[model samples]
Target: MPTITEAYVDSLAPNAGAIKNGRDLIKKNSFPVLNESPDATLLFGECNGSGKEPYRCSVDFVNEASPVFRCSCPSRQFPCKHALGLLYARAMGSPFTPAEVPQDIADKRDKAEKREEKKKDAAESEGNAPAAKRKVNKSALVKKFASQLEGLRLLEKLVLQLVQSGLGSVDKKTVQMIEEQAKQLGNHFIPGVQAKLRAFVHTMQTEGDREAIYSQAMEQLLLMHSLVKKGVSYLEKRMENPELPMETGTSLEEQLGHAWQLAELREYGRAQSGAELLQLSFLSYADAARGEYVDAGWWVDLSDGTVRSTRHLRPFRAARALKEEDTVRAVVRTEELFVYPGEVNARVRWETATQREAGEADYSKVKAAAAASYADVVKQVKNIIKNPLADKTPVMLVAFRSIDKTADGLCLRDAQGKLLPVTDLKTNGSATSALIALLDEKDLRDQAALVMFSHRLDDNRLSVQLMSIVTDSRFIRLLY
Candidate 1:
């Protein structure tokens, strides 16, 4: 049986409130374990709730990285308090005699095992199938690649037109043109790029500072054009030689908007041999123009000094409300993150994660491992400018001596007294202003701090977008 730890149980709780309530119940010794048992892969328990019957809670730990929680409680939160309490008790090493597994839990486990067996059998059978089927599949894939190439061509043409016409003169017709091409790209399995196009169009329609907006729009057009060009070239090469190993880390396909199924990614993470497990800290930003929320955060392999970024998106209503008070950071123990295809600080994705309280981040270690100086950041931005598809590169800057509001914009001064201009200060309403107000109240303008932000290279200039600020006492999230 796998040993359960209190930290692991805390990680399973949905929020701080749940963790507190569960711990309170455990402290009070109110949840008497009515039944308890552990198999090779699961833990089952019945805990007395505030009702006649106890709440039956079962934890499926067959896949240690992605545990499934089932509870009889009516709470909507995943792993409600009852489940947490049960786990907390087990983690505390409460003495309980083993009991026979309940029929319902046994049946569920059996069904899941059978499904796994069937999947294995099917995979083995397919692997042994005739060569004719494999040839047909390869032919189909080639045709699909051809269609994607065509879509890329269409997108490239649209981007060229946008550039020639000028963003300042963009109107409904120009928006329609981009939208049509975006639809085509979507159909070609490039929803990532399609989403970018739609976001560009949305920005064009929305009222904003016309000059700044136009410049940003032009920057986006150039980036999309580069992405399409590279995508087409990649497809052409794949078409020419099918056996060539495709780049795996955040791939061009993902940057072009390919959606990764969480389930599939999780399974891949589990099956990956000799992959390291690392804990990550998560922060989210709302993209109002795209009607989506982007989770932007980092993970560190404490053993190897390997730092990588993890990002995910969710539509407006579908996004979860991140509680400011609760420790919303995810603790990823079982899942291994795979970085996007190309190098230069690629984005990462994982199968799944469990929320946990994040302790104070080790600013010194993270800075030594991942933080870049202002000069290095600018150099990196220049490199990305050479390849426009590498937009919004994640950057961490440490020991920023001061942040001051200038007539032009916000400027962050590094320890060496170099300044970087900050833009896109606000994403969610008034967050930037709120942060400024907090800084004023706390008198932190001259204090040293760590800034977690992204840099966008556009129109031969680098613009820093503020995402979060970490002070000694707290983490201030500027984008939510």
Candidate 2:
């Protein structure tokens, strides 16, 4: 399923919740206005902004009949606030409308209707509509793969050029050049490679050690080279045996074939610690929903078990009301001491008795305190990166472009200023391909400088400003 982007939410917000109360309810859920339906769907209702202050429970009409509505209020589940809220929100709409309720909800509604119909058609009882199967075209896929290969080649050549020129020190222009290329490549859906490149470019901006940064770029180049080779090999094999059955004969189910294969690849990649990336779902919950997490605490995991970690309290932003469907619930079980990805280092410490007391006693004061803590963390992270790693590991630097109309594996740059050829590889196999497609279609000349932020698990403190490239100086000028 296509994840909802911020733009999608904003577009729906204007219509789905066009009415005041409806809008309020919609905003409280903080979920996106989904066009696709899940099995059970919740409908909108009136925004009853009553009760204990900011926490307003919207009414909702459930799938059940007798009462028709079920709520989250203390009284009864029959006509809950959640159901009412959903119905109210749906009642008043402008350009927006519920594209489709979830299949589950439809099933319930259908069941309700069946109670009135006595005659059941034999054909309807005997037949079933199968789930739709996703299809892929082999030739078209190969062509797309080939295009991405070209993009990879372009990135490699760019990086080599920098390496050859002996301009080890990266300036703003260099950063922009690399970042823009990477961004373009990101269009290909190769988040793994894009992140590698992004990491290098970001490090370069604040790096005190240019040599390490250069080495990092080189390492990434090598990684791309390896990935492309593997991809090409697989593509060739598939072409050779287009109709070959798997040795394991796991193709009993056609619709799930691709998913199973992808899963296999994911497991193998993880085991190898190869170019890997994680899909991050970012969400913010309203303060009113904090009750769910009042007792939760974090369990920090280190990439390498050797790194020491600690958690300290910091203020967090609380929504005035439960955020609308725009908000997402935290998947992690624990509540963050401050923010999910708290700053590694903080400048304005919040350890003071006054700050702690304010945070515990007043919501507004606590938020301010968290912001201050965030500022400190940003400074600390910068400082940490400035000092070369104690082990003096070589850093990887990368740059690349993308393929057109795709967001899967990236077309990686190779040694010959050509993209690593993936003519034989699957084009829409993974997120990497998607990223590659996206990057290939992007324009980097009008590049946007990377923005750095202090990210907690679920929160990002955006402290830096967005910068753009300037040609004459050939250096990235810090934006205010």
Candidate 3:
């Protein structure tokens, strides 16, 4: 028998708003628990909802770390507010007298256990299968390497052209050329690279200011240069030693935008520990011509402090339908995460989750994990100057004292009077306005505010893209 903690339960919430709503239910005593029991590996409770009868809610903690939640509430949110309140009560350490397990709950738990056992049996059988079926096809492998080599050549050529012509010459025609090259790379089975190129083109097309766009373009170009160089070297090594043992997917493929299968990644993640859901965000990229919308989710490993991300893309019109719950932060179990293949900080997907007790949001802890000084961040960025992918490097500035409005744009200053210029303010006008309003309302010139941002190096100057602003009483996410 294992106990559920507040933090583990909170990890099940879809977003901060859900947790708040669930808390309201508890505070209002809206769903009074009628019958409560904690058995060997299960917790059951019946709570009065809006309906005539109480809503039956139960959490199966047989898995201990990753519990299963079920509730009769009609709410569309998984686990529903009723379920959250029920678990919240238990997480608060409310005493539950020992009682006989209800027949219904017993049956459900038995069925779940049987299903898990069957899954284990199937996995064991698969593992015991003949090794001949797992043999690699040398010819296919060679063909893939050759295709990647060709892609590397195309990428190298593209990089050279971008550098020679300069970011100022990047126009619709230039974008078209890059798009065509990206399509060719996709044909070569290197979709990771294709995606990176498409993202770069999208940024260049959407950004309005000529100088700012150039800076971003140069950053993208540098990333492409590094990726191509690394990819070529990796492929050459594989060609030389075809029998080399690679545990995970190659870093070159990931840098080139190769995505791992969700099922496989999930299986791999479940075998390890320390996975926790961290944040969720609704991302949008659009111009007059086209639009893209994505739901991005982040997970962090509590043990090793590794970060992974998952993304769900929707149609352009779907952007308007997104709600705050779609982008909330929570902690989840590692088994619920499916990690993408990468050297470090790989992307991940949410496989399975259940509602349980939740804990308070700790912004300080998150900031600490990602915090770095302006100089340190700049030095790190310089170290990876050859592979300057914007998303890969995130910096969190803790307790900056003031926001200085520069002639060009805004800048943030620390208590020690160090300054960091803010760049990539594109597509975050609302957040920017909100921060400015907070600063004005609070007279925060000398007050502390936390800033989460990323760096962009261009023309020997380091600039930051403000991602989020966190104060003592407020948290505003600026990045989409």
Candidate 4:
């Protein structure tokens, strides 16, 4: 029963296809040979397949934290559909005959135990010394900084030229020219900036309100311009001190596409232990420009009021190869939480986590963390939005005295009568305002909620999008 929950089963799936296929196997009762070891630590089954012989699968829970999934199917995917189906069969209370552990499974477990024991013996032999620090090649890093600087110069000039020409005049020929320039940025050690350039071209090609498209495209250019300036200065500083370790968590580093390792963040003092978190809202979107699917979640750290995010990006090219993240409908207790670099709502990652259904006490913890006043939140938003390199949309939890419809639009008011208008922004296409309008005004009164503060590019005004509302009895999630 260690990994019997639906959530755990969902987590094992490599992609949505596996979940569907696994569920289909259960519904069709494809497993005529469902057997569980007497101790309940091993589960093995034979699932009927297209072939004459059934595909043999087994899930060994010897190490409950990381169950071993072995299948005889030709598929390269880990925990193939058949293996997942075996787990599903147990979770669903489908009859599994009690039997002794199969010889093959027992042999594999013994081998794994021996390998683990050897690793422990080796560590003990060395007196458990810490891992050596990853060596940095000073010369290569200095050259990379130099290349980045050159890329910044080239991009700065390109952005200026595009601005002068204006978005109105952008055409097919211009896009082709831009495409070639974007590819050239790759050679200069600035793939992050290159992605932005490519995103600009993508925006122009998209069909939408011409003004809206132009607005979005112009925003992208503004960010590129900001990155060019900041990147040049940032790299110049690094170029001066090539021996200096890379900055841990900063907007410039994030924009420059630094793939942060957990160990690296720990080295820079960005890692912490005993962090409790509750997911307030979740959303998934396809990033067309980069050809990746982004599964983003907004979580409230129970320890502090600061909000954090976990983004699991699965590239389109490796859709099946990577494990896709699903919405976590429970509270997560992580052993160590690693924070990524950013000014607000910094991306975060964790290695080990224990999840449980969020209870009322957890909700109270989140409610208590909401900002005291709307004015304070507005001030914070203003400072962050002004910086082009900062995350334009920051998810914040606010304590609202009341929700009302002013002549201007739907607004959430604080106790002091300061009102924050709620509207859909170009960056977040989800229309939370429309959803709010359908609900009774009384239901929105006197509540703590998680809202995304966004700067509308079309009109350049600050706006709020409701993500979730925490009431006295229930947590109402408006977005997922």
lDDT of every model, 2 decimals? 0.62, 0.33, 0.60, 0.84
Candidates, ranked, TM-score: 4, 1, 3, 2
Pairs of residues clashing in candidate 1: 192-257, 193-256, 249-339, 249-340, 249-341, 250-339, 250-340, 250-341, 251-341, 266-351
Worst 10 residues of 2 by lDDT: 347-356
Give all TM-scores, in the order shown: 0.67, 0.31, 0.63, 0.90
On residues 180-211, what C-alpha lDDT tens digit does candidate 2 reach at each position?
88778756534444554665665566545666
Q: In candidate 3, where is summed lDDT lowest over 10 consecutive residues?
A: 280-289
Provide the lowest-lDDT 10-residue window in model 1: 322-331
In candidate 2, how many Å is residue 437 off? 49
Q: What is the lDDT of candidate 1?
A: 0.62
Clashes by residue pair, model 4: 249-341
lDDT of 1 at 197: 86
Can you write out model 1's per-residue Cα lDDT over 335-410, one digit (the tens) per residue? 4555455554455555554433333454334434534367886776567645566545445444466777779777
Q: Which stretches of candidate 1 lie over 4 Å from their true place?
A: 1-52, 58-68, 73-81, 84-136, 173-178, 259-281, 285-292, 304-306, 315-332, 351-364, 370-373, 397-424, 427-480
Q: Please give the RMSD to the true structure for each candidate, in Å.
A: 6.6, 21.7, 6.8, 2.7
| lDDT, residue 223, model 3 | 79
